[model samples]
Target chain A: MANARVIVITSGKGGVGKTTTTANIGMALAALDQRVALVDADIGLRNLDLALGLENRIVYDIVDVVEGRAEVRKALIKDKRNQNLAFLPAAQTRDKSAVSPEQMIKVLDDIKAEGYNFILIDCPAGIEQGFKNATAGADEAIVVTNPEMSSVRDADRIIGLLESQDLRGAKLIVNRIRMKMVEQGEMLGVEDVQEILGTGVLLLGVVPDDETIITSTNSGEPASMSDTSRAGQAYRNIARRLLGEDVPFLQLAEEKQGGIFAKIKKLFGG
Target chain B: MLADLIERIFGKPEKTGSVAKDRLRVVLASDRSKIPPEVMDKIRIELIQVLSKYLELDDTALNVSMERDEDSIALVVNTPVHRVREVKVS
Candidate 1:
């Protein structure tokens, strides 16, 4: 088996759906038969476990593993839904300072020996010590952002930080996009955000703003696990793309009009 | 929807997206260059003050900013000097 590739999901700003993206992507990847491990690197503000609905199953966290109080295997919580998936929750009582980058590296190195295909680290918001610790052991980075100014700006900063770390190029996942708003000129379109952030950075995927995400989080099941939600399909597409599959982008926006309207639009050179 | 499509195809000339693009370009350029806003403002003021000693110029017409391309960042300063005045040296 190949060594697990550590990837960190990060956004410089909070509440931009980093945790949600991490959970769904991990779950989706696991569903693809890849042995995946999701690490909650938020430290004191732990939430990835909650997003995974494994909050109640945590016995030992990362801090305990780093402190040598618990073995790495003991600290890892296997997902009930997927036999190949696992989680390493962060300590809730301790802060980011409790864990060192070297410790994280050691823990991840141990996890790699267990023959995982992917390791997804859920980084905390902001470019602080927590972010530093999260990205320390990661080999690649995925930046989650909203189709807005503040989120895009912060994502730019995060990308710069990732570049400085000498890690692989950071790919973007634009979340919570409202196509109607873009069509109405009320919000930035995907192309607009891409233009501002620079096209040199690759785009991994886009997730539309779906009401099912809220319901999924409330129920402790990732939206991607659902069979009928568009957001879930989007995440699944992202997972497939990550696995080197050429999946076409989903057409989330409805068609503008019918046969006559389409003909008119074409005639207008639209 | 047809109207919207036609407008988009021909273009309504909506400046919202373009405005954001322009603003983000300026902001990201400065951010990537690691130049603080206050420092940039100070540099602009000092450049104008020093240049005015020799040339009659329009301060409002002056523009000091940075631009970026694929490879490098450029410092562009534009001072609209009306005319060059003759001076006698001892």
Candidate 2:
């Protein structure tokens, strides 16, 4: 509530790691002893609960609280990993239009008063009404995107809309980037994506497609706990960086293959 | 990075269908630039609105499009003037 940063985790297109980033980043921030609340603003096509592995624990949702059926504090679902981490689940039965931008603003304001260092919103995809409502209270946003064309394009559209709302410092979080695809010219690299979007936005982080993220999503634990997963470390580093700590960029995936001799050595060692 | 490593070891593109890749390229360019298709309509409407205010012009005969390069957006306006000399050139 003191000096919290309200950030919306959004993507112009669906399936672009918005929810995963929200879950992991919220968990990472909480793990760092920062009070964090992740709001599920996806409404109808909500997956934040499932991604955070709290789908089963959701008895009351944001819609219930907004509709006065439940209190805002009562709808808050505490995470298993960190008690400081709380989640506001979206209504599965209700559509995005069921809640207005004003309701979302009120809920966020209430949570801010509860003493959170960072409030993350897992926003739904597309530049539709859902996107508009989710970003209403967002002080800033992290546009989650992949290096792929559609993701980048959608990210650009979202960036434009965010700018229209007068939200400054909207950062980019490049997710599931395959560095090999960039090397061989099959996919656009970081520079290409950045150039196309133009400058002035900070690169919050680049997340690799580490299998542990998928596994963690499946098991209901965030990928931040996976020591072997490159993405887990990346999310933790992002959390530290968000806290104003100077963490160096990590290699999510090797850009080059191992030397033939090393490959042969690995084969022998195996 | 894994894709490139696999391609290097395999020594070829992963699959066929560069056309599918082209579709991605085109769509991204259009969508990411935040250039809506509705802008073309607005251009036509504005042109007709302005032209009608001055000389009588056929609205259906005009063509509005964008000439895009690696940089800059150029709004192209093409219209046939029946009497060029009679019309006031702006």
Candidate 3:
């Protein structure tokens, strides 16, 4: 009966940017005046803390909370940048099997009762025990994938599994889209991915491939905090959409020739 | 530079996105069915064994694959029957 909406950010293939998405989305939500908690469910391969620059502050983790070694409040790490944001680090020494789905549910239930507005779980790659544990108590899901065949294939598999789990159908986030490549027809476009992924899921948002994301991650400052970053702005729009706001998607690329008339035509055609 | 700019303004580049789209369409269809590529090979072998008794068929001519559409998975099996065995006179 808790009011918190628990959402899991997942991708079946590794290195498809699940951790980065979780960190950015959590930071963006927290910036919007919501109490946000990011749970790193990768267990042994925990890196969400590093993305958030909270690696040094982790004395206790999710495993410790589940095992009763430390209280939940003691294990939660406060974000230096945002007072509303908190992070629950994962145990780097233990494997995914150490945490069960039931344990994950219990932990989420406890976090929900603490008055968090949103809980974003960073699920590990692969459709294994780690994935099951991370998604055990999620009310909705956000499936992340790149603009390549391998990532999209894995994402389709993950979507199939998520639908069968009886939770709300997943929202799709096509990440790392290079507009140049997409225009050149070298990479899959957003519409192409949506067609192959089917109409069962809604398109949450599209994030362009931006270098600012890498720079921000390296500096432990989320791009969403920067007004100049294109990827950061995309994430902000997504956050607004999640809050039920009618925000227009950002125009990342511009046409150089026939600009005004072409813009009108494209807008009407779309 | 002028030619390149003109091409940018008007030329239609070779559509490589369609390549990714086509490849993903087939691969994801097969993947979501939970049947591995190796399992399809196994099915081909078993199917040949069962069909070889009734007709003389070319072993290399058989194909077993999952055809995927927007929402359904269809198991397609194609094999050419070269010659059927004639029944003996009673």
Candidate 4:
């Protein structure tokens, strides 16, 4: 029916790519001509604007709209690249309680009226009130976490929180993965994450660890806009999966040599 | 089934996978219960006190264990039986 779907992307712990994931996904959606809005729910540590390259234009924010200091449309900053994408920045001065959960719901509903395919909430780190405020209005949740121990631990807690809500569906998107490390038995693979979470991941995409991401991020350009970037490809895959497409995971390494495992199987055939 | 599940859940953790799953599971248990292992020990002792009034039991008989089931914990008391005695009633 073209009604907007609200997805709060969160990991209970910090620095696991919540804002970056939200930005890339918003960019991907907008590229598909889907009207998308990314709401930065991280009030205190707000950086979605910097990541999206709209930091200087933030004259109004979510707190402004919530507290009646500004109109919702006034605070909405259209993306420099896509007319279909807009960002509602979090207020830097005020804290999380500056806006209540009900206020967030009202904002989402107002934005939906202007016609959008999706509304993404860039939830702050931790299981605190900010997280609560971010999630309270969403129909579904996309739990973002790294394959690392601390990230997964926080993800588990976030998963439990999602289960407590009206969960349209909760999907897992693992970020900053190196497939070579996974193949070499140096890193955590997708299987390990799924088992501990004890659920089916609706969408699984691996953003490879590339220096390009940090460089582009620092320069205020999303990696998703660059076709050659590996991290962009991963986010693109996730966007396709979100739209209900079946795409295989990225094979980052050249493993076509039919290695020792294949030889062992052939030898057992006798 | 067990082997398939083992491979599925643990996912052949080279290093990161194992650490991630282990850390997540441990944290999740506490998150759901809102009670750490430290507090659970005290709760176990209190539970044993009530059980002692009904019957004479050893430590083995009074084992108190908990399992995480989604959002709640399933608590069980495993009681060992050495003798079944009936007191005389006039």
User: Whose DockQ is greatest here?
Assistant: 3
RMSD of each: 7.9, 5.9, 6.9, 8.3
- Alpha-carbon deviation at A36 in model 3, angstroms: 0.6
Compared with the true structure, what per-residue lDDT tens digits does model 4 show for residues A60-179? 999888888888888899887889999999989989898899999998888887788899999999888888999988988998978787787778778877787766458988888776
**After superposition, which runs of candidate 2 have C-alpha atoms over 4 Å from their true positions?**
A253-270, B1-65, B69-72, B76-90
Models ranked on lDDT:
1, 3, 2, 4
Q: Model 3, range A1-270, lDDT digits (tens) per residue?
A: 388999999989999889888888888999999899899999999899888988889899999999999887788888978988999999999999988999999989888877899999999999988889999999999999998988988888898889878765799998999877776677898889999999877888899899998999999888888999888888888888889988876665732334777888899994
> Can you tell me which runs of candidate 1 are displaced by over 4 Å?
A255-270, B1-17, B35-90
What C-alpha lDDT values do all the predictions have? 0.89, 0.82, 0.87, 0.81
Q: What is the TM-score (0 to 1) of candidate 3?
A: 0.80
**What's the C-alpha lDDT at position A55 in model 4?**
94
User: Candidate 1 falls in which docking quality class?
Assistant: acceptable
Please tell me what DockQ candidate 2 reaches.
Answer: 0.14
- Cα lDDT of model 1 by residue, A178-198, tens digit: 877777677788888887888
- Per-residue lDDT of B1-90 in model 4, one digit per residue for the tens? 998899899795446545555666777666656657787788778776765655566745566677775556777767775544454545
Q: Which of the predicted structures, 2 or 3, would earn the higher lDDT when compared with the native?
A: 3
Worst 10 residues of 3 chain B by lDDT: B27-36
Which candidate would rank higher by DockQ, 1 or 4? 4
Give RMSD (Å) of candidate 4 vs. truth: 8.3
State the DockQ of every prediction. Answer: 0.31, 0.14, 0.61, 0.40
Cα displacement (Å) at residue A83, model 1: 0.8
